[model samples]
Target chain A: MTHILLRHRDIPDINTLNVYKKNGGFAAFKKAVTKMKPAEVTEVVKNSGLRGRGGAGFPTGMKWAFIDKNNWPHYVVANADESEPGTFKDREIMEGNPFQFLEGVAIASYAIGANAAYVYLRGEFWELAAFLDEKIAEMEEAGYLGEDLFGTDYSLKIYTHLGAGAYICGEETALLESLEGKRGQPRVRPPFPPSYGLYGKPTIVNNVETLTNVPLILANGADWYKSMGTVDSAGVKIFSLSGRVRKPGNYELPFGTTFRQLIYEYGMGIQEGRPVKAIMPAGASSSLIAVDDKVLDTPMDYAAVRTLGADLGSASVIVLDDTVSMDWVVNKTIHFFKHESCGKCTTCREGNYWMRNLTERIHSGKGTGADVDLLLNVAKQMQGKCLCALGEFSTMAVVTGIERFPQDFKQAVRSNS
Target chain B: MSLEKKYPKEVKQLLAKYPPEHKRSAVMPLLYLAQREEGYITREAMQDIARILEITETEVASIVGFYTLYHDKKEGKYRMQVCTDLPCALRGADEFLDNLCANLGIKVGETTEDGLVTLESVMCLAACDRAPMFQTQGPRRHQVSRVHDRGPHHGIGRGVEEE
Candidate 1:
């Protein structure tokens, strides 16, 4: 089937404004602005059953609806900080089908009554930021953006903002803080971004993939999108296939695609034809899934993956074959989280630091079984204490690795004892 | 020199992106502008940015301190950040980094004798599929490169020779 969100996969030069225009690009934004009310546009999304692709799986329309109507000017900040280890789908979307994504941003701005929007890209994407800035300028010149878009009083402008380098900034609140030129640490939740964000104004922060779905959902009817994916998780998703696979790249498949199909059919199986040992459905933040016949055949959806004790987060499948060890995997994830802890809440800052020390000692063969147990205990202690998901996510691989792959830890610690 | 005095037009354009009352939001971009010429943010530039944004220098310095991209001290002309995170490591990024370090005769986070490139291992660059990829951050430029079998030394040598 032709790609839906990843339209560039099917069409040539879809990144170009002219080519994108010819292929029914801005028609959705034009239709929404000319024919429908903002609430009506949002209603269509509400019925479509679209969820945020940014791991949390929150309902997209519900997030848009939560914007404080009493507040003077709602804002839309696109979370383009695609910093997750195995996730590279958003980068492809922004580079390949930029107009479609920008059009989605436009439609979302119209839906939430946000005249101004910001795309917060990670600092390493400086070139991508320039590329997107050019795209935003192109939209402005075409009169699709700027004051009085589509000859309607509804004006819209989209700007690209760059985060210096902080994984925690992917959190919406922390993203807002970074956009505001503050340290990229997450904020306390009670007042989420929808109620209080970006200079204390009500804002809608949607992931690039989530907002990219907006224009398509608007162009095609809600039922068209709902028909693609499973009931619980509707529509197609770009699975970022990476690590130990023959063909590791972005595979835009429907939500229900199995791991077996992704790794074998799309990704062409593991490297060297080695047997698959485990899978990290998410990136470093994933629980290490001990691969079995049931898991290999299980449908890859949020709810279904939850049955296997993991969220199909951003759907970045990192295949680990038999050659790899779980101890090393846990160590790598710990170091990542420790480096990116943001040091805001004591739990995440200290927890990751301590976990890193334990994982290092355990992985380097300098620790006994006591250290392995201590590492598991430290990780468990950090589970419910973090101010943000980063802290909670830090312990996932560690806890899962110890519990599921006890033999790996036993072997790792055996050498030292 | 102050950022406003050096590039008045660029400074104005950066501040224009944010509202006048909330122009403090322009600090990150301004920090980038200040670091454009030197590849590392200087004290004077931070002060200049702090003055322009109406925030304290500490506020600006705190930002430089917090984010990894904004370095406060001088280093090589170019910073080559390699991703050795989990996915990349799974695909031989760790070995790639080790080989690059061996080729350079300097460990990670050290500048070459020529002072052209400073190698550093970083977190994921979101290009997991492209294992052994590295991004170069120099004055006014940041470029990500996929360093396959030929080794990154040739690329680094070419980059140095170009300078």
Candidate 2:
């Protein structure tokens, strides 16, 4: 009910320096720099049970702890390349509550002993990046970020880097490759960013929303941070509600909050009071969740979404009513994935292209039941074999559309054929 | 256009990270430099950059084509790209685009004959709420020094005074 990770919702104009400071914005950074040791700060974050909000849900503290401290001049990269379809929560935080996100970046940098933190934003976010640059300069002027922050040895500089509008860059390692001024493509993991990243140095990469939550976790203490969400997935999560909802916007609720509460209560119910037919709980990347009473009442979190055979990735809930044909939805998502595919891997690049053609044919009312079966087969073939999540996640809608809403696909096929 | 003078010593130093044999590794920075110099990448200038990188012109062309930031042709002084994606489209984007076009006296893909502004339709620019937005690139510069400091202007930078 109450916002934890996204306190800016309650506090107006948090983007402004004065308002942010008044709400004790930079307190976490100050504490981390002045009083607490970097390791201690990392320990607090580790104990808070904060996970990466960038789809994977990897523990934030564990990610920070993964940084090879022996590698000097460590780096912290904030993944602001939120290109996932139906995701807009990060944009809100970066544009409206930038300073809070910056403060979180600062704290994370300190915890990881990083001198420089780069916010790798999507190229479309150039204006936001410029705004963030101005904010960073403001923080630097205020001594909140710069040489000897808070008059301590802990120094941090925040830089904003823009991606050239590649969906693959949203993948952490691919983001690093792009930040290092390369073609945005995913690198092999296991050397996973911590050991080798950004010109081959230890790097800790976290999503924009994930970093935005750090300030709250540090300022409120680990136990306080843990008190908000379900026992496992603690703290509040921002759900970017879109499609068919009256109040389609970002809703911040505790991790375990149910989909019913998010869509009905916060979203002001479906637009025109239409009957909810389906839901994409986490943008185009998530498997479709049938919006029945069981799913509506299901707790909205990383773990709970799994029970419904989906992920709470970036909490980009795309609601669909009976009016929207499932075939059309899958086709749209397939088109996006196909166009945005980086072509670094075979499965995603080729699979998405093939699926897109089939989906287009299906949505055009030309595809038959055999075509639907072929699309499903292609999507299944793409699973577990993508170079990055973009390829892997692209199959979600296609697979789920045929599996859960067979009637919609069947009707679409018959109508078209 | 040569980057010798425009990038200055600091940028040159930064560019030095790539080996002489593989100067193509600096394509991203070079693209940024070109953007800074000419506001946006042109077809000829991009080909020239490919020449400098020692890579095939097609490779460079594909890179520029893939990314929305690099414009293939000349853009107007003010390019307002209104995103017509689902989110913005849902929030009266059509009306917003209509208003913008009406005010600018231009269509979605046309630039003002005076080269003052260009209206374009682009995929999600990542700003959903503040949707129906567009960005403008300033005019292209006329002069830039060559890499060897030999004052021969190439590409779009030819025949203008060096800054």
> lDDT (CA) for every model shown?
0.89, 0.77
**Distance (Å) between predicted and true CA of A135, model 2?**
1.5
Candidate 1 local lDDT, A198-279, one digit each (tens):
9999999999999889888888889999998899999999999988999999998998999999999999998889999999
Reference contacts reproduced by model 1: 0.80
What's the TM-score of chain A alone for every prediction?
Answer: 0.99, 0.97
DockQ, every prediction: 0.73, 0.17
The top-ranked prediction according to TM-score is 1
Worst 10 residues of 1 chain B by lDDT: B142-151
